[model samples]
Target: MDIKQLQADIAAAVRGNDVLKCEVQNALDALSCATPKLKYLEIHVLKKDENINQFTNDLQECMKELGVLKGILPKVF
Candidate 1:
């Protein structure tokens, strides 16, 4: 099949499905695990305080996004 047709099929399938709570929770858990290691590495190994701060902030934003998605998905689907 052509790429365009394959893309359409995948899109259609995705639109029909609901994102499970477990999936979103798993993502949050991963971010929680990574954030600390990232912070420590940035402080000790990378020795880039600014980068660590930015990375931590980005992680926080991602967590917020996932939390919102988690809350909304149940209502949506």
Candidate 2:
């Protein structure tokens, strides 16, 4: 190939590489921005799960107490 043609090819390749580098950098920045939000969402979900578990336990206790009260009291109907 002629020297001019070779230089043109090298310049095109360098531009392509720069474009790819920018794309990669943009993807990394997006992930960096999303990571903290993801962590916060995870922590919020865990807290809600804990609250649900506590509510379930409390409901179970109430059911047991109701059962005991039913045994102690007579039906009116």
Candidate number with greatest lDDT: 2
Q: Write the per-residue lDDT of candidate 2 for residues 1-77, one digit (tens) a residue.
A: 99999999999999999999999999999999999999999999999999999999999999999999998787644
TM-score computed on alpha carbons, candidate 1: 0.38
Find the candidate with the highest TM-score and give its number.
Answer: 2
> Which sections of candidate 2 miss by over 4 Å?
75-77
Per-prediction TM-score = 0.38, 0.92
lDDT of 1 by residue, 1-77 (tens): 99999999998778655455568788999999999999888777656767788999999999999999999999999
* Candidates' RMSD to native: 27.9, 1.8
- After TM-score superposition, the amount by which residue 17's alpha carbon in candidate 2 deviates from its true location, in angstroms, is 0.6
